[model samples]
Target: MKKNYFILLFILIITSQACGVSVKYSFTGTNLDPRVKSVQIDYFPNNAVLVEPSLSQTFTTNFRDLFLTQANLDLVDSGGDLQFEGEITGYKINPMTATAEQTAAQNRLTITVNVRFYNNIVEDDNFERNFSHYYDYDADTQLIGSALDDAFEEIIERISQDIFNASVAKW
Candidate 1:
């Protein structure tokens, strides 16, 4: 019995070592490479028709925070291995018509962010892409303002995840 237990323990240790864990992801033809050591993310400017007073700052700060938490790269003001900059290119809210009553019953808010990224360490790896997401709330809700604020939070979360996946996760 003791011999069997020792064998099981040894096998478990070997199998765990063979699992091939890695912090960096690998993609065959993706622009993301693991050579990057640092990143610079400039403040995202807002160019949308409907301006939320703090939307730009919120977006920029959120993006930075997301990267800091998700990726292993360090943040730098200049001379970084990677760099990104862009703007909030679009924001819109439109009424959604309810099919049951043939009337508007809710509003859909959509926000779009366009980012341009360059990998200075890897000359061939560069990306420019636009990522957008939307959220909706009932028209009858008295706290429409708060609902919109929540929508923006969700949108930013998605955008941050998308950017991180594109830049590091190789998706």
Candidate 2:
């Protein structure tokens, strides 16, 4: 009887595979529809009043990498099951705290992005909104070289994750 049960189980597995039965799994806490097999991220230009030369490309690339790594979706040029398009709308640097001598002690860099997300499979999931985040540095430090890189890394990582949460994770 045990030998017969083993044979039946083997046959069931083979039959499922032959029928092309498959299950979509998500290890990233994603709620993406199985039919959403591809995505397109449009180039996000910097429309900020305070323009950073590299901000546009950096944000776009980082945003694309997030979905590629987490969503397991194909990158397509157009007509994807899921699509993201946006522009950088705000980039501002301001003093946050002041020293006793009336000098600036800390500064903050804030970036705002306006995103338009489309989910063809789930129309209710589509959205257009703005997301913003910031990074703080010492007032004495100039935002250049590694400091700028670090700020971009921190800011973009946050914004991209926010985008992922909104579009893919449904959070």
Candidate 3:
């Protein structure tokens, strides 16, 4: 009798835990749908005038990592429930302002990315959008290349976060 009681108690505990625990924000006004299990992200093509050899790979990897860390989803190459493709459309540097001597004092570096997201399970959520950000560089500052690289990293990070929130955060 005690053995049967313990088995029943264990089963009850498991069932109660499963029922009590919920995935917060897994759904937006709708119940959590288990149709989507895996995701696939393609390499973002860089079509910007100033082509950085590693920019495409960096963006793609960062995007995949963001989704992996933020959402309870898998990453697959093909036949995934979700897929994303994109291109780096713009990369430019322009003078920001004039100095006291009437010369260029600061520069603005801008990067733009266009992304298309598809939820194979839900066609309505699929869409394409372009995102851009800029960083300012002072003429007085040295190491312009490194500074620009850092800025690019930050911009890509923000973009990745925005994409994740838009797709999975359901906000």
Which candidate comes out best when scored by lDDT? 2
Clashing pairs in 2: none
Candidate 2: stretches off by over 4 Å = 1-25
Model 3, 1-171: lDDT tens per residue? 999999999999887775543434443332224677788999899999898787888888888888777667788888878888889999887889997898889887778999898988777778898888777878676524777578778889888877776665654
Residue-by-residue lDDT tens digits, candidate 2, 1-171: 999999999999887774443335599868876777999999999999999999999999999888889888999989999989989999999999999999999999999999999999888889999999999999999999999999999999999999899888878
Alpha-carbon runs more than 4 Å astray in model 3: 1-32, 141-145
Error of 2 at 8 (Å): 15
Locate the minimum summed-lDDT window of 10 residues in model 3.
23-32
How close is each model in CA RMSD to the real structure? Answer: 5.6, 4.0, 5.8
Shift of residue 122 alpha carbon in model 3, Å: 1.2
- Which is better, 2 or 3, measured by TM-score? 2
Most TM-score-accurate candidate: 2
Clashing pairs in 1: none
